[model samples]
Target: MVRIKRWLLAALVMSAGVSGFMLTKGTSHAATTDPQTFISTLKSPVTTVANQYKLYPSVMMAQAALESAWGTSTLTTTANNYFGIKGSYNGASVTMKTAEYDSNGQLYYTNANFRKYPSAKASMTDNAKLLRNGTSYNTSIYSGTWRENAATYADAANALTGTYATAPTYGSSLISIIKQYGLNTLLDASASDSSSSNSNSGSTPKPKPVVYSKATYYGASGTQTARLSGQYATYRLYNHVKGTRANITKTAWSKVAAGKNVLVYLDMRGVKKDASTGKKTTWYRIRFAKNTSAKKYWVYTKALTLPTVKYTSGTAAVKVNNTVSGSYYDHVFNSPYLAKSMGALNKLTAKSYVADKQAIKTQDGYKSTWYRIKVGKQAYWIAATETAAAPQYDAVTYSAASGTKKLSAKYSKYTLYNHVKKTHFNQKTYKWPAGSKKGTKVTVNFKGVKTAYKTTWYRIQFNGSQTNYWVDARALA
Candidate 1:
């Protein structure tokens, strides 16, 4: 049985305003006949006011459109009051007939005094101040401190509908208008422009895209329906989050071939333990191609190779070695107290690259460190302890200048530690081969320093031997 989560109920309630206002019937004005023209003319002023108030311009424009009827209302044309702000401003006022709903939901017609602004810009600015600071007519809906609350456009619209408007659908109506015209895109574009301007002015650059691990699933490719059995044998596909399972029948299953790409939608849910292996692993809800009947599924986190870095726009370029060990996700949870297991790492490809590293706090309050790596375009996380810095020796050209240092004279002999291969810095010490003897007359091939260990190791080739070995400088005389 899959569990469903209720995360969107609060947003629905806030969108459905309980009370609403009715617009008074009036003749349209010829000066602002086109809705598009009216909206375009006011966009600049509306955005200015919204930015000053930390409110969404889309919400403000929608409210103005509703209250002024696209600038055709007599009150808007004559008094430049697009927001129906009622009060004396600079001692200028206009008496207008409007409809209001009483406490018992009864509609009543009444003549009220409205503020007269010098221009539409002034009217829009004053409207923002009214909502942000509040007046004798209503308390501040956004916040007592200016521009501190109302983090989103929907939040500002909801607050106005709940406290500033008398109509039940006022908030939803504003949202509809904003969405119908795709006004949020303009808001986003404006923000991007601001970020660019800030960068040109020598300010701190905008945040770069955070790199994460990319994962893949290796399952058989075919359309075979198989019922999941056993305790925790069933992999539930969630609509979103942990508890919201998809409505599709549990008996339906589609398997893809090993190394097939699965696009990951969300990775922040933390780790789940694999019941069969008793291994702590992270699960990714992945999206498959349209051709696949099962468009989405949850797979074991270990079946994919995580990259070392995920690059984002505005991030500084970092040079990284492309080689990594096969062991991934051994103890990479955001918590350290959890027991470590190699089952997850054993499922991934033998080698990958490290893209980035970060310290994270897991749900259980353990400080687990992780590394961000990429396998193709996808990102995944792995335990920091499982990987070591492997520099590309093939990319480095060996020359006399690079190997000027000779073997130390303190000791005359050195034992071979594994077959001569590329030296690894900052890694665990290699064990000496059994029955190996130390010799003093080895020819030094290269002298290099491992930055991670802060030590020097000599790459040496013994007389008439094709193999080379890396011996610590401390071990040679």
Candidate 2:
């Protein structure tokens, strides 16, 4: 009877201790065998959380991998609890068996309560909060791991050893995993965070370039030209990351590519080269208007196709077509090349200016056309709205003009007009930055007004030039 009572008492004590860590089974979030996919899954959120909390993402990332065994651990797979954090999360908890050290420094396994997170982001957020805010007893306990506090990620890792986990080698384990997996490449080049190396501290983590996402979005120094192949859904980039799905229709650059030949204004976003194979991908941002104040979209330079511009021998002429058109840098290029435009040559010089060459192709719906020309030794491509001999404008059509206004702004465009059709031929070009008369209010002499369709078109000529331009009568006031 004594032995029986003693055995029962021992069982009761075990049950009470085990109660702290319930061993009930729970559902998993996601499971994957591919290490790359697993890393990709947590990288963005971890980096974001690190950036937000001012912690070394490298150390944090290493901890996650070491703790979750590359996201295969039951805590991670079942509860998305990558850090094995104790207690309930948002009132949700999971019971799981975990390894713990005993009073004699012996390792033992027992069930313990762990936080159950809704997603990897939630788990990451909770971990970041702990590292940043520390525990209830000590708020700055993990401050040594912060980018501001530690000079390098190793220091941060070392700081976490006994504090973050009971293991004395936790820091070295994190450092080893970080090196083995190459998680330090982009430590200084986080999606939107300022470079960590900017601080004088040697503790800033060196980079192994954790590719958090498949898309490699980067900033560029200049502009290029490209076209949208089709309607691409747009999103507002948060943290410099493509985030927050927005209603595409609400933006002005919305639904722009509707099987139309309308050209897009583009800026070269830059070319990204793969570090492994040296393969390159050129990218650009699209704008609907010439102004920089408008929103822009991203596009692959490869998709902005321009059929080989086959030039024929012999000079051609452009007659007044009374519609606006565009011209490109003889070829679409990645700079040391520019994608700017200028108002085409004046009507008088059209013939000789195009003397260099003339050729046409099956243009989709080019509005108006021009070819390579030269002024002195400098080569340029100019356009005029006369009759284009070889080019055809077949894809889209424009409606008759309406609501004529003589409105002008500080950055007035140097627009060209066709006398025959009394319509807009082309606008002032971006004349390669300086030496432009875009906003000069040339003195005008009014010819007369032709009222039709509830609007009036007024014919006028600038004081010094014989070219007659029709402005809406309302333009004078």
Candidate 3:
């Protein structure tokens, strides 16, 4: 049976897994074992993630070191995926052919997806999340690794031997590394009292019991989602730190976006005074993917408020109607009449939602069609002109058929389409393959079935070109 954690995710120089462990770069073995440098470099980031996620810093740091080969592993260097966590982040991923044992316990080679992260800290945060959330099948499978649940980091380390990895020695390996580097030996550097800390080696205090914060900033002014109006880096606020700008790094989320959605974390907002200019910059903290991790980033207000919502809606039921991308709202609106949001859909994992109903709404003379999108247990609305009528495709396979077929003379050239997107593959240039001129025979392979139209599609090599352009039965007439 397939391991629940091994479910393919989005990756890297090294492929992660279809089973347990995938392929890596030219060097399968770890290139370096510099534990000191690795621990030093990752200490701050691991501490932050552990503190936020309620994981043991020592266990997490040890896992990172062992999995990423002390930060010299191919996957770590190329993809920053220290935990061998496979899956995409924000539609980003890398692929590699990995050697692994399938559920049948037979070794095989296959390409697998691993999540790509922006920073090492980001990967650490994601890894911590996996432990906290566990696999979809078992939410409490890794609960033994929680700082609250585990009496010590050693207990947490042992919990991963079979569950986190295929090796029986995985836990001992981590323990050795931790002991060698004195990773878990420290109570916590933050509690610096010379009297108690310097008193004795065996006398260090245990960590204070964790208190879940009940503070909700929402009741202040409430939250809203908005896209960055323009490209400007965000910074974190450190009230306890002496200097304003020096407290936190300036680049929180640097990727620029015009319509990129952000979950506004607070409505009261914040203002940071520039050291040089004395001008206070208004900042709004937000999460890029609201439904995923709860990690937050800050963005200046102007870049977000600049893009005005301009969407065209259509009437009649449509398949995978393009997601309602809103400029001002945090997500698709809950209703055309209300200003509430439904959260943003991730680009890679977001299957097109069906808009089954449409209504006309006029706000301050801005008239548009409001498409009601049904997702899961609830439905939401997006106001704009509708252009979602044509059918798209579902699961496709590459077996079954391959050969040549003659097109009908009715269409000298037919517009090529992206079967999955339900949009023209090429807007201007590609119509029918030049070799597929009216009634001409063209090479076809990889049969696909699109449901709504109940049609068949074939991957055709156009004009001896390698690109796999798609053509449905309509071209065959």
Candidate 4:
């Protein structure tokens, strides 16, 4: 009888070992298989949760990735708590001490309650259920892509404050993740977020034409012609890059076909090149008065395919007018560049001199106003309304000179209609160095308003120049 009992015990032990080995193998396979499998499995459940809450799947995925470490976290494995959710879960709970830091930079330890469940799937379902009922987890106002990278999702899983702080590069990181992992593909209708398929026909407005108000020509050699006409005539602007157009939209630039020239508008905005691929895009999004939605059109330089226009000092020119009409020959400005003395150009700093307002497509919009000028330079079509009389200056000297001593401070601020320069002061603050001879003529030229401040306090940028700051009229002695 004793021998029989020993044999039965050995058989039971062998069975236990085999079961352990099988469990380990199964776990290893589940961990190593494509993460997308897990993503797919959770899609339906995630979609159900999002639809009930009207949340974006991208946002939900971000939150999940941040809390659960893509289902690999210790909390998920041990407790089946994907969200690190703190609270009592029926009678099944765990009490633990965790460190926390306050905004004032003080750290303290606190014991809190955590929920324990049977599996990750169960944890996820319960988390959704709790979020639906919990007043604190109110998912209504909480929605946005987490990070641009998959690894960031892991870090985000640990975030206690539903949202990661507004750290620099948050948007870029999330966007990069979406692009790399094709997470946006999960946004398809069949995926977790059904709203992706909802068609709101009335909400979308009709597409509008992109208006270009000005154009300039770069000669082979060198000569800047300030254009007077043909700002929006659609003659041609060259593409800065070569690639297949992917996200091109109206006014948005796209790659031109190989060996073919593309004419794009020179909408004035800084261009951006993709960090990974060299594809380029424009920045202008100004809109016209008629079509309010026209503002959505963004102009870029990379969409066009043409001989690149080399803008040299003398070759770069501009023109301003009432409106952008049909395609016509560019009547380029031939007059010499204008220059202004300190007395004329000094105060012209407050106003913004736009080189091209045509990119905005607004009716009667003007191109950038001239802020740089040289003396004795003459240009045609100088808008009479835009020009301001040269500032009158009263000379100041230590010794009695034959000139008037009254300062120009009392006169109304004057501005230049065209680009002007200062042959004198460099810094915004110019004064007589101590112990110098009194005959040194110190004249303060009146540049126009610094900025357009409305209330009792005034803070203005230079209207025609680059200087923008606070200037006290009383301090202008």
RMSD of each: 20.4, 23.4, 23.6, 20.9
The residue ranges of model 2 lying beyond 4 angstroms of the native Cα positions read: 1-30, 106-108, 191-477
Better of 2 and 4 by TM-score: 2
**lDDT for every model?**
0.49, 0.50, 0.54, 0.33
lDDT of 3 by residue, 168-192 (tens): 5777988897787787755233322
Task: Give residue 391's lDDT in candidate 1 (0 to 100).
Answer: 26
Q: What TM-score does structure 4 among the candidates reach? A: 0.29
Maximum-lDDT candidate: 3
lDDT of 1 at 451: 59
User: In model 3, where do residues sit more than 4 Å from their true spots?
Assistant: 1-33, 186-477
The candidate, 1 or 4, that scores higher on TM-score is 1
TM-score (all chains, Cα) for each model: 0.35, 0.35, 0.36, 0.29
Q: What TM value does model 2 have?
A: 0.35
Per-residue lDDT of candidate 1, residues 325-366 (tens digit): 434332243222222233344455435454444434333233
Q: Please give the lDDT score at residue 333 for candidate 1.
A: 38
lDDT of 4: 0.33
In terms of TM-score, the best-performing candidate is 3
**Worst window of 10 by summed lDDT in candidate 4:** 1-10
For residue 344, model 2's alpha carbon misses the true position, in angstroms, by 99
Clashes of 3: 21
